[model samples]
Target chain A: MPYRPFDGQNCSIAGALAIIGERWSLLVMREVLLGRRRFQEIKRNTGIASNILADRLQTLVDHGVLERRRYSDQPEAYEYVPTRRGLDVNPVLIALMQWGDRHLAANGPPRVPVHTVCGHDAEPRLVCSHCSQPIKAEELRVRPGPGANEAQRAEPLLPAD
Target chain B: MPYRPFDGQNCSIAGALAIIGERWSLLVMREVLLGRRRFQEIKRNTGIASNILADRLQTLVDHGVLERRRYSDQPEAYEYVPTRRGLDVNPVLIALMQWGDRHLAANGPPRVPVHTVCGHDAEPRLVCSHCSQPIKAEELRVRPGPGANEAQRAEPLLPAD
Candidate 1:
């Protein structure tokens, strides 16, 4: 019954949605994140139409999520690479995978993430930035910040910290 | 020129494409992430069609990214909350914002994130699980485990930790 495109008013999440929240956009990102930098490789994997893929690539390039680099001068070939802005999208893709694996998998995780550094399988644990303590939803509090709206008077949205 | 979605062939990202990689879904997630729990608020904020909002919410609930909770018994009022699975999707949303704030914003970040534990602004930093060192794309090494398909070769996707 709801449309949840973004959370807070005028927040980064909202701003992001305004640009790349369309269908096929993140699919393109998934390919770049997965190392499919070449146009042909990404096209082969996703099965997206050529025209649509071209548009999505241009959009991502426009959004700074991908950069188009000339791969071959003979054919004027190009490959799309994630910039810092693009590479940062990995966590989001990982988070989405965690959701899909949990709810959608027929077997177990259709895919698994290996924390290359952990020396073992790794699960991301959210920790408090200041205290360095592991944080959970109940353990955290939310309050109106500099961006709070005039109508948002409901007990700071979360319990006081 | 290429239809990149099918080429890289990592299932988690692929599965993410089957669900949320479509248009309007992430923006919907944005609203949910921002704390709008009702159908009306989501639709209002996102300007999505009532039918489309209904469909997206159903898809999310069906996928377990969000759960429908009864707010009242009489009318069977419900609100959506992230299961542990749903909250896990935050990183993707964050990544999208990082892209948006950097490329889309004319000024600076339209919104900011705060580390609830320390009571100040904090950004999510990816760290190497092995050394607990903050990780950048260049520092990590990943080899596919049992999950690697024919599509995923030894080639590292994105920059390694």
Candidate 2:
């Protein structure tokens, strides 16, 4: 099937998904962010096939999320490094890790993120940027913003609670 | 191609991806969480073809992330609802939305999540649950936990900074 695009949606989640929503995309990012920059290393870590890995890496590079830099001239070797936009995907991966640990891990998390500055296990939680208060899943609602389409704007806004 | 499984990885993110990693899966969840529960509603809102939507919904239901309940008997209609496991995916979606808004959306966010308790836009940020301090992506590192396999445990640990 040809790639499905979420064009004209005006939704940020959709926009983000357009770039990194493929099944192997975020996993590739995880490998790179974990310091497996070489193709063989990323492939070994992710278990993605060579062709698919090549395609995803190209897509990430095309979208400006990753940059491929030459590491060896004679061997023509390259390493994939995260660009600023690529680094921005860290929160998304962290959130997924937390959810997976809480809901799916039977033996406990396979890995845990640690806050280097504080030298403590970083159990990341979402807090409201405006009030700096913790935000729970059920304690939030949504409203149309500047980019909402006509139909979305007409939909009734309701409190999640 | 047949569905690819991330088996024997022993990673929570990989575990979660094995369940909800398909391109349309999370978008389907977004529709349901936004209160579009009925089949026609979710279909119209997401623009997902019937077969693919059916597959994604069934996958979610099988994984215990969503529950299908009868809402009508005469026509034998059903509605998909988020279970506790499903609701836990909110943080993942929220993190993606924040990333999209910051980096993808050009006209501003199409919708903004509001903290019902504070009655203001949530603008969620990640903070360390241990130290209760905001966490930067660069200021974190990962170490093997209780579930790590021998290979993963053998990998070198490096500070994210």
**Best model number under lDDT:** 2
Residue ranges of candidate 2 with Cα displaced over 4 Å: A159-161, B159-161
The whole-model C-alpha lDDT of candidate 1 against the native structure comes to 0.63
Put down candidate 2 lDDT per residue, A1-161, tens digits, no spaces.
Answer: 13665767778887888898776889998888887789998888888899989999999999999999998999889999988888888888888888889888898888989887788888888898888888888776688888778887998566242
What's the residue-level lDDT of B27 in candidate 2? 89
Error of 2 at A153 (Å): 1.7
Candidate number achieving the greatest TM-score relative to the actual structure = 2
> Can you write out model 2's per-residue Cα lDDT over B1-161, one digit (the tens) per residue?
13656878888888888887676888887887787888888888778889988888998999898999998999999999999888888788887888888888778888889887888887888899898989887776788888877987897576242
Error of 1 at B117 (Å): 5.5
- Return the TM-score for candidate 1, rounded to 2 decimals: 0.76
| Candidate 1: tens digits of C-alpha lDDT, residues B72-143 | 889777888876656656666666665666655565565555566567655555554455655554333334
Show what share of the native A-B interface contacts model 1 retains. Answer: 0.32
How many residue pairs collide in each prediction? 34, 0
Count backbone overlaps in model 1: 34
Give residue B84's lDDT in candidate 2 (0 to 100).
87
